[model samples]
Target chain A: MLDAFGQPQSLVVLGGTSDIAGEVVRTLAQRRCRTVVLAGRDRDGLDRSADAARAAGAERVVTVVFDASDVGGAARAVDDCFDAAGSVDMVLLAVGMLSHQRDELDVERTREIVSTTYAWPAGALTRVAARMSEQGYGRIVVLSSVAAVRVRRANFVYASAKAGLDAFSIGLGEALRGSGVAVQIVRPGFVRSKMTAGLPDAPLATTPEAVARAIAAGLESGAPVVWVPGVLRWVFGVLRLVPQALWRRLPG
Target chain B: MPERTLLCGWGRTAPTRACVLAPEVADDVQRALAHADARGTVARGLGRSYGDAAQCAGGVVLDMRSLAGIGDVDQVTGEVDVGAGASLDSLVRATLPSGWFLPVTPGTRQVTVGGAIAADVHGKNHHVDGSFAQHVAGMTLATPTGLRRIGPSSDPELFWATAGGMGLTGVVTEARVQMLRVETDQMLVDTDRFVDLDGVMAAMEHGDADYRYSVAWVDCTAALGARRSGHTGRAVLTRARHAARDDLPPPDRHRAPSPPPSTWLRAPRRVPPHLLHTLSIAAFNEAWYRRAPRHRTTELQSMWRFFHPLDGVADWNHLYGPRGFLQYQFAVGPGEGAVVAAVISELADRRIPSFLAVLKRFGPSAPGPLSFPVPGWTLALDMPIGPPALRACLDGLDEAVAAAGGRVYLAKDARLRPELLDTMYPRIGELRTVRRRVDPEGVLRSDLSRRLGLDRGLDRGLDRGLDRVGD
Candidate 1:
């Protein structure tokens, strides 16, 4: 269970191999989170992340194979994680793909991006939520992006998928009200992690360590939505008001 | 009119918004229930319950403070019909002057009679007198169905269910209680300072029956204090009995037995930042342990000073800061004393400071299925909630307590899991049955009931998630 300060004793990371997720787990483990469950498709990456959690002072670490693109198996994979851990106090949903700018007509790639970022995570989160509701309390932290504020011409596929996740998370928080379950949406501008290592840094770009710190603070405050740079909340507020023609004309 | 209000238990955690209605009379209680929306209603007193037992979120909370009155005491029968809203403080003041005292008084006098019965609160004298409900002669209950007068003899099932029922049975409007007769408003207390947990446990087990009231204050920080000096788990044990008038010192022989004083001091209204911590609490514990006399017998002390010392400071809960504290209280049977020792050791070893750790011996429990006390020892620990290690520590203790056939006090609980409720209290099924009979539509619900999933049917799943997060 999450303490009054919003630090969970045991947490599960859906995309355990993600750089941001690994950083968050290590940070929380140092804060006395004793149990960590890392689920991802890469066995070697999951092993490495689990070792990091152990070295960071987690008393127990469990890893399960999870392929987010396998939407049909998403719920089962989630159940396996929850079953292995028993009662889960928090879950970090960090599964997403940052595909490069591509033709809209590349239907196969679009399907995979959408399913990995939106459909699979949404299905798994719904199952995780049900388990938590039955347990009577839990916390869920969903990683989103500033790109979700408005889908630009570049990387619209990835951005639109994050937008769907952002909306779902907000609604989930409202739905769990008074039920002792909470959902937090974390929107980072641009994180210099494995996913974006080769990409050009966006304005107010941050490191995985910085995003992890923001997530820790957000969890402590039980904030519904967290912006990594803090300034981006207002940045997005104004950006959301930009006219479509002007937004399209602006360079990436 | 019902007004939206945020309410929490005495520990001051898990605050939830609810529509509150102060019901001055019995009819008002009925009206509030009738007008209650989809969210049900529950009665609240001074809200001394440590958790959400009295708080129904997004629902109606019938504030019973207005149902206030004290009937004329029946001096011959030693019985009094007191309003549910009448606090033990007021009742103590009124009756102590008449040489009649409550049979059982918890650590605080601020608790309302309704709350006392609802939680079936036990005092240091529980080993002899049982809980508050054991002394209840009869009670008037306002349920969703209608008003019903019940008592242990007349309706044992509902009467016992209502005791420690956490207000789910009904809103107890009035109760006739049998008070104990005392010679004076003073206590003849014996204080013994023990060097460790075993010394105190042995003394209490052998000697508690000789005294009417017994309690021990354990200095949990002494595990660290011991390494500095050589006293491990030091504690101060006090056992007391009502003093006869002749026992008083000659200086005040002519004075009449006085009422207990109201709050003489108040805690800070706003939380002071990091006011309590391991170092500060260790210092306090060391001082407290040293302050007690090595051995003192027949010391004359005011009843309130002996029983409700914390009452001297009002709003003391604020000292824990804005996050408040968690009061984890659990009881284990005779052979389970090892669990008690283990729990204290765990806290001491972990350096998790508990400002107040009370140890008491309990007699046979009352008939209430949910009554916390059983036939052995119980400990109550008050710890501030911010420590990252606190939750896992408590969760581990919960398993230990349950494994030893012990159960945590629901009144003092906020985070107990649902799966272990059955293991701890097998008779809880009986409580569910009684609640169903009285409130079939589930008109009474609280955050506690919802969290424990108490109102739901039996056949509870035992598949609990890993509650214990170790080192």
Candidate 2:
């Protein structure tokens, strides 16, 4: 359902999805969404995801193959998805990787870590965010982390990476303001998913299913920030103000 | 700002605003009741009720006055459909043409049909007709469960509950009230006044059964030695149901008085903060003796002019000025009446002069949970408004009344403390149970409710238990 301008008017996410994007899709669906373009890198994963989404009751789902690390073509890739569908209603920036913590101590490895986890995704999403702003009716959802609140000695590199991304998401949302384009930032704590398999459970860690619910609820509630395992907002609030000596002694 | 609804009782005097709904027809009453039942609102009548009985504190009072229609009068059966808010004056006028009258009239005709039913008011005729509830043929009450047309035949428990149920049972919109066929608008004459207080009681007790109407007029301003004009007047409408049809008068027709001189109004005395004291009261008593009458009764009086003389005064309360007077009307329950009477006499002996004294005999009490009447003697006395010292005197009366197992009238009270009220009426919790069932959403309320915390909405027995513990 492409317009004469050949831009997507709506979008959807199939299986390889971000929690916040799934929520934004559900919100639009409730409001009677008509056309949607589903974009992801894996065609098979997208098709499989589409089947589940159609079952969960999305009216439409389409897939676009792309590599987010290829920043030069990222903006063009977004336009193609809209050209294939009708127009873009939402662009969910849920692509990221949690680099190996021990590998980050190596300077050369840290550059790779920063590129995969931050630089490319940041640059690519900014281009997509601007495209949506030009469309004049768009929603950009960015996945953030609670660790972005403060960088600790143990996870400072990961925390710092998230901190930069969080600031980018917030600043991007503000830039889109008055353009009729809105941004939603989701901040989830340690969430259990296939990506986090084989790792010990973190205190206040939440499951993917829990994160999904929080995402959808946040979109419906129009919240600026979200914390999974909901009470952690308060839990982390207390953690931030405690005397440093007392805080360091408390095991996570 | 959004406002919450509250409930008002007959004894409370505070004013509050909630949405007001006055149902006009049965169907309207039903719809309002259903809506309030589904949601909730307090159904109230002519805010004439003394306390919160007609108000729902923060809630709207469903002003029942809109249901003021007096249905077709049954000249044959002496029955009439009275809209809940119809005043007794209107009902009497509408029905008297057919030679019928209210089975019982309270001290005032200004009371609405619904208010009378709620209070189950009685007059000098209580010894004969019992409370007003006894003569109610049927009533239409709007409850949480739609409209229930009830009477002795339909849902007897609820019927009894609605009779003297105060407004808690539901909004009683229209009632098939039984009217008595009267020989005339005028009552058969008889009057005998006593010189002393005991003579009045002795006369009422010895021969009250002989008269359908009996009452006493006391010179409250009489001196200690001579003012206790223990004088009681008694009368009965002659059973000879023969009225010269040619002279048939309207219901409101009654004898008029020679207007008292403006100076006759003692209210101008300003009731100084200390005027109600022992010596002042004694002095007033001495002056009352100067205007003497040992015993006497004027004959052939119109029933309204006799029972409800206040109806003629327009705004009689204005006579008491901005400081509105408090009428302490209490009756002893069974053996308690004697103690109350003794207390009243003692107050006079102590020089606390009551401007008016009305004594009557109550029949077997109504089983309504919070019905005020008991099987004993009752007295209604009025006192001019004054300062704190006078309040202390009333508090003393309250203690004695509560001690004697008696309660004051809620509709006539303005300053009674809650402790004595609870002591007098122990069935408040029981009444609240029915109130909640009738209006689950907690809507019906009035100003009086806020004063005494009647519709407090919380059932924390710890407070009650604590009060008992403190006692």
Candidate 3:
């Protein structure tokens, strides 16, 4: 249950080790959020995130083993997370993979990227939404990317996965309307996180904290969609109208 | 489960969305409190607090109205155990037929028992009977931990904290209140018109003790003209007391009339945005002042007319329009009555249009730390949120009030600066200590608490935790 000030008492993060997810939990903990459930595969990374959440003010930090790429086990994993943490006020789905452009055509890499970025998340989130609808109140935050607006050749594989997830999340929000469940889609142009460390800086690049703040505010204000830099929504609106030749010619 | 909806106080300003849940029983309240998310939960009752005290943005709002049940009244003692969600109107209807009335009631009977306690609301009879909490013998508070029955004698600290605690301490489930015995449902009101502020103040200071209820409706607009001639603060003073059985007509003297159910006049759901502008309000005030007799004594008036005239016009707040209005009410100690005069003059000088300002003399302050009244004078005025300088002017008045050892009523405050909170309420730290004991995790929170920095200690705890992790 979110309080009158929009502070949640407990939060369950599916990709708990993600930089953006950790930042969101830390911010909420600072505002007196007492319970945090971190679900991820990396033990050491999960420990670090749990420690940060406790330091940020969470009274209890529960870490659960989760593998987002285990598409067949997604439903069980989500159910386990909720079973461990009763009545979650918010569930953040911040899982994705950035396969190299050269590996885009490789069958195995393509299958892995699509499975990790979209297939497993969609499977798990569907289960999460069902549980939320049963309880009649919950917020699900899906981290998409600006790449989904118009898939450039440089990151078409990752963009396509995000495009599928983004559309699914929006439609899911509509499906859950009046059921007391909400799905917030967060799109960032380029976030300065460990995932994008080696990539060249993109225009309107933001930090994990910035993305976390935007997500927190969006949930507080009950906004359906939030853009990290905010201006990306307008930027993408114009990019979508550009001629195909001009858009394709643009450098990465 | 919580449903998202926009809620505003009686003043109708700064509407915010909250996930509202109506809990039917004490257990429901406990479950809701246990699950309330980070934003925190605050209990709401009748929404009569004039400001955001009852509203919690983005958080769960426990609508206690579902807890409505009036228990058997103690015939010998005039004591009753009433649900916190039960409105004074309902209680009055039930108890009045048994020859009893509320110990203290504000200008309206629509307020809930929980709201009355949360505000420690003062009625026109404050000089005689104190506030609503003074007569409350015991109560059941559903805190984040669990439900606990407390009273003034048992755990006085928690009891006083919950009283005027603004529903921050916990959600009041039920209260054992002592009702006042009355002979009739009518009042023998004495109406007097004063030509200047000093005249009315002098009359109240000298003769108010003679009556159980007294209030003055000052014409702020009329004072503007009087200010130039060195005379100001013209008002219409009405003082009254419960009429005795023999005071009524000979035919009706044997029995008290049953109080009327409040279906008098219904205000339109939506009025023009600027219906109560300067010209219109001024005209209304002028006519209202002139309409009262120069001096009338022992005039027989119904309980509805004397105590809650505004209740007749349901949804009167909508008349202020879409922009809404702010009810700026402040209290100053004895010898600081000039502060009231200065505020009225200032509002008039700024060309700020205010409806009839209510001026009342407070007898003494309650033991509750956050209670708004004190031994002196209090004035409440309604001004539209149109003037560009309205915010600045009110801010200035806040400083002046604080400097004079006065405080703005939190129940009616929407814009008081957080920095001035401690100065206005010196005992806030003590209240915080008591609050933490009841709500250790800070599960109970509201928009007003966030706005006034009452939740600072919760954040401070986070900083402390971070320090420990660093060590």
Top candidate on DockQ is: 1
Which candidate ranks first by lDDT, i.e. highest?
1
Proportion of native contacts kept per candidate: 0.09, 0.00, 0.00
lDDT of 3: 0.84
DockQ of 1: 0.12
Give the lowest summed-lDDT range of ten residues in model 2 chain A: A1-10
Q: Model-by-model lDDT, in order?
A: 0.85, 0.60, 0.84
Q: Judged by lDDT against the true structure, how good is candidate 2?
A: 0.60
For all candidates, state DockQ relative to the true structure: 0.12, 0.01, 0.03
Error of 3 at A126 (Å): 22
Off by over 4 Å in 2: A1-252, B1-13, B30-40, B221-293, B296-298, B349-353, B456-471
Off by over 4 Å in 1: A1-252, B222-232, B458-471
Using TM-score as the measure, what is the rank order of every candidate, best first? Answer: 1, 3, 2
Compared with the true structure, what per-residue lDDT tens digits does model 3 show for residues B205-315? 999999999999998873335447543478999999999998999888877559766667777888887899888888888888889999999999999888888887888
Best by TM-score: 1
Q: How many clashes in each candidate?
A: 3, 60, 16
